[model samples]
Target: KERFISLTIKKKQQDVVRFLEANKIEFEEVDITMSEEQRQWMYKNIPPEKKPAQGNPLPPQIFNGNQYCGDYDSFFESKESNTVLSFLGLKPRLASNVVLQLLGQVTVVQ
Candidate 1:
């Protein structure tokens, strides 16, 4: 599958401030801008589904040599550490078969 994230947002301190200032309806100066309460007010007005979820949700992130890294598959399963890794088709990268145990049970990965 695809690696980690579907969307990426990068922000720098001053750049974010400048962008916010530019978006402000009547503000030409970044110094005189909206307060936190004002921004929060705007956010609260948005619908629940329209509101931000605030996290990355992606699947089966594979690295070079097809090494997949993710936590979605961790739910519901109880296999031995090495056995779990073997089941996921991760025989090459994991040395000494160190499968990270979860819920005091099944191994997570190689």
Candidate 2:
């Protein structure tokens, strides 16, 4: 499913937009630059710990059906790990029974 992205007109935000476009990922963008209310909303909604120390919340704050998926670092990490599909819930979290056993949720007989 598509997701939402909060952004401002900045290099980092632009990079994220370009990344999503290149990947053909569907997303709705909210421009914090145009709306003070939106900016404040973003500031309030995003957890304080996630914000940078010196400024308001940065752009490209991604949301997966209302769940904050994190910023650029986390996003790219997911991409690099090929976990985007899993993050999007497009694929099963555990690809094999071995994962379940590793998590101590199942017993492996071998």
Candidate 3:
């Protein structure tokens, strides 16, 4: 049972890392298993409502510069809804916006 849980955690962590890398988002992975201080920090930063009713919250917790984003399930939902950038507190790219400057005239696309 413990091994199964560990595997599940590992998979979730991998999924998050893969998505972040694919999107070219810079992130730092902290291994709570290696340091008690890091583990405590994670637990402390998580919002009270997000904490599990039982044991400590599992890994694969997402954050944007100390601001807690959410857990693995939240990340999956955001990905499904195409709101990952907003979920991570990132500004969306202006892909559809067009900017043109011609003859000292500026045009902005909204």
lDDT for model 3 comes to 0.63
1-110, model 3: which lDDT tens digit per residue? 98898788777766766776686655444446766776777788789999999988777676665677787888889999999777766678522222211111111222
RMSD of 1: 20.8
Best by TM-score: 3
Model 2 agreement with the true structure over 1-49: per-residue lDDT tens digits: 1133222224455565565556555444544556667556556666778
* Model 3 regions more than 4 Å off: 93-110
Best by lDDT: 3
lDDT of 1 at 52: 39
> In candidate 1, what are the lDDT values of residues 56-103, reduced to their tens digit?
222211111223222323311313243433444445443332222111
lDDT of all predictions, in order shown? 0.28, 0.47, 0.63
Model with the higher TM-score, candidate 2 or 3: 3
Q: For model 1, where is the 10-residue window of minimal lDDT?
A: 25-34
Tell me the lDDT of model 1 at 95: 31
* Residue 104 local lDDT, model 1: 14
